[model samples]
Target: MVQDSPATRARILAAAVEEFSAHGLAGARIDRIAEAAVANKSSIYVYFGNKEKLFAAAMDRVIGDLSDAVPLTEHDLPNYAGRMFDYVVDHPEALRMSMWRHLERPSAGPVVTELYERKLEAMASEAHPSGLPPMDLLVLVVGLSGAWLTSSRDLLAAEGGDPYSAERLATHRAAMVEAARRVVDGV
Candidate 1:
């Protein structure tokens, strides 16, 4: 066994993110991850215990970066949604990992639950024009934020050339923000 080191751990985490995002937890291969990370396959098991734990660690890293990049703004959900759209555009892998998590591991881990609870508390502390419950508003805003990304590529392509072009992205971002505003303000 190779001596454990922080650098090897970091490489493993990075490789795991790419692997899990592309194949999900069930389909991900530790051999591929080890090759990508230039570490022994056994290192992953040593560091993360198993595939499930490794997936969780990879999600934690992605979620940590996402939350740090785009925090929840309870009072201005529209702007918050816009920011989320922007973040997803920059880090599409994060979205893919999240989708995979929902598909294969539907339950929220403690850290994810804690983060969600914090957002719920923040939303409940404020009153919106729509008067919808905090959880409902949060779900709506988040859904709108990622709606474009989750849309079928064929559907988007049918609209025009390069659905992900700068112009299209700007247009979708504006629409998503407006939809979020309508939900929050009932306008």
Candidate 2:
């Protein structure tokens, strides 16, 4: 029997996240993941069934972590977008993973779908509702939050500045927050 320990599983997950983020689903290799994780290939199979399943599991973890990292709030949504930008700044791999998922994954977990649904339901229940349509707020917030990472090159060139400049990063984050706030505050 292939007894998978929590430690081993975690290592595999960590390695898988890096691998998938770097290479997406098609380019990711089981051997590379196994080597980086220091776990056997059979163990990976036993734990996650296959590379696709491993990818799913890793993405599931990412969404779950994001849910915790940026929980929905009754107060300022701009703050929420700011928080997301801050998070992405620190965890760019999450953004890469999301990009890869969107591009390479034809479908994703119901858990992520349900998470979005829950957010939509929450927005629907807001007392001072933004009046945005279903999932629009969520979509807008995500797009605004990630725009910096996706558009750094263009933004840098347009702004005539270094991408890594602290001022530029702060400015980008502020814009993301303001954009989200506008969307949420809009009808």
Candidate 3:
């Protein structure tokens, strides 16, 4: 058995993210994750107990990374939306893994719950007088931020250019930020 360490654990989680993003929790294979991580299957089981737990851990890790990368700026919702759009554009797999969890798990784990609660609290504490409640505002902002990236291919290809090209991404990011501003500003 390969020795277990923090590095090995991190590798497993990273590989698991890729696997789960591609195949989802139901279709993800432990052997493939272990092989991708250059670790053994026993290490994964020892570290995460089972495939489901591993998926949870992977989700937590990716969400944590996103939070760290783009700490919520509730005070500047538009900038926050733009930053989120940038993050997702750079790391689409993270969003894919999150979508898989939503479909297969359908329950927020502790880390996700805590992070979401924190964001809600922050939004509630903000002095802005948006018409919508904090939870709804947050949802609106998040939805607007990810819309371009998650939209159907037909909609994306409507412009007859690479939807993910730099120019198109900038345009979408600008529109998302403006939408967030309007939603938060109640305009």
Candidate 4:
């Protein structure tokens, strides 16, 4: 329970995020994090215990930042999806960090579970009343966004494909809205 100054703590956390996101727990280096934070290694260890804990904390902060960027709301589904896609594109680092975590089985920790549960609650509140369960709605939301974020590169490389191109994104946005409508309408 060391009460570090906010500025120092924020810098360490930011640096840790970049390090852990770029290199998983096994590959991440405390020296690099310290350098990036402009703080000594001792401070990082004192604040976060160890590299594993720091990685988890960094991930948690990323999740918090994302929640702030896209506060959950009872909005239309397609609009929500569009916002999610836009956020991921804008914050590519966060997306990459998350993907790295998924790749590295850090732990089945409560922080991740709670983050997901919050997402589920928001999705359930916004889901179309097609009798779809909360989990299903959650899956749909995550699945669509995950597909877009993870596959955007490959999708773009496809012939005549350009996922980030204005026209393609717009079309995808429209299709997502229509899909939501159909799901909700039970069509």
Candidate 5:
């Protein structure tokens, strides 16, 4: 059994996220991940097996972290959106990685599907309204994230702007939640 420090694993994961985000699984290079991690390429292969596995693991870690950060309860919608926005602001790489994955349409390996299903289940459980279909809620949540990521620059450029400013973010968060509530409430 090889002993690996948590810090070392974290470094490797961080490096993997960066590399994968910049270049999809197809374009990402193991050498770059090794260089960024300060770990030998052989070590990455030994630990993660291959670039595909490493990319999946890195994405899984990020998704898990994000799920933890954004609770799914209806009461948590605004806060959840805010946290998501905060996450994108802090980890733009994650967003880039996601976009790349969507664009590439890579094979849905176990790790990818499992994490995605978990998120869908969580979203269904949390946003399950009395009359609304679970899929609708799912779409709403996913759409919100998509809109934020896609329109972030435009939002930031608006007059009196500062999309990432705390106050503006809070306002946007509240508005999004209210919009969701209105739809869910059938108002």
Candidate 6:
């Protein structure tokens, strides 16, 4: 049987997130995850299936944390983007995981789809006044908040500035909020 302990599962998930974030699904090794988690490889397979499933579980856990920590509303799109921005900044690997999933997985799993459904429904209810479809607005909010975290280095290089400067981060964050506001206003 699997280790079947919450401690072991949590450890594996933590290790898996780090591994998958650093190397992605194909490059991540089950042996490395097991070593990092202080569990055996067999235990990981039993608890989390193959490497793909482990990656999915890790993504799901973090996404759930974000959903709980940053619920969205179309009326408060800017603040919603700000919260998402903060969360993505604190956990940049989550964005990396998302990008890797899009590249590596053919389609999202049912659980991930369900999470989107709930958020879309909530946004749709409030988005009628904004005149933009909920999906479009949702994409804008997440993309605006996360775009900097994912591409700041290249952007900074083009601007001839430090990518990790506090000033840069602050300016980008404020811009994200303004962009979100404009997206709503434009609609």
Measured by TM-score, the strongest candidate is 1
**TM-score against native, each model:** 0.90, 0.83, 0.88, 0.75, 0.71, 0.83
By TM-score, rank the candidates, best first: 1, 3, 6, 2, 4, 5
Instruction: State residue 135's C-alpha deviation in candidate 5, in Å.
Output: 1.0
Q: Which residue pairs collide, candidate 1? A: none
Against the true structure, what is every candidate's RMSD?
2.3, 3.2, 2.3, 4.4, 4.4, 3.2
Better of 2 and 3 by lDDT: 3
Listed per model in order, the count of residue pairs whose N, CA or C atoms clash below 3 Å is: 0, 0, 0, 0, 0, 0
Model 2 vs truth, CA RMSD: 3.2
- Report lDDT per candidate: 0.88, 0.79, 0.85, 0.72, 0.68, 0.80
Give a tens-digit lDDT track for model 4, residues 1-187: 3555777778999998888777866788999999999888998888889887888888888877886787554345556666777787778767877777777854512355676687667756664566778667656765676565577565567757566787777777677766755664565
Clashing pairs in 4: none
Per-residue C-alpha lDDT of model 5 across residues 1-187, encoded as one tens digit per residue? 4567676677898999888888888898988988999887888877788777788787777666666765555444544555666677677875776677677744422244565567667656664443566556656755675465568676558756666677876677677766655655554
* Model 5 stretches astray by more than 4 angstroms: 1-7, 74-82, 105-131, 152-160
Off by over 4 Å in 4: 1-5, 106-129, 160-162, 165-168
Q: For candidate 6, which ten residues in a row score worst on lDDT?
A: 106-115
lDDT tens digits, residue span 1-187, model 2: 3555998989999999889888989999999999999998988998899999999888877766776897766356788778888887888777887888789885753355665677677667766457767466666777787787888576558867587577888987877787777777775
User: Tens digit of lDDT per residue, candidate 6, span 1-187?
Assistant: 4545888988999999899888988899899999999998988888888887888888787667767777766468789899888887788776777788789874543256676788778766663555878888778777888888777566659988686587888898998899888887774
Tell me the tens digit of each residue's lDDT in model 3 across 1-187.
5565998989998999999889999899999999999998998998999998998888887777888899887778889889988998899877887788788986644355677788788778767678688888887888898888889999878889798889988887887788888888885
State the displacement of the C-alpha of residue 185, model 4, in Å, after optimal TM-score superposition. Answer: 3.3
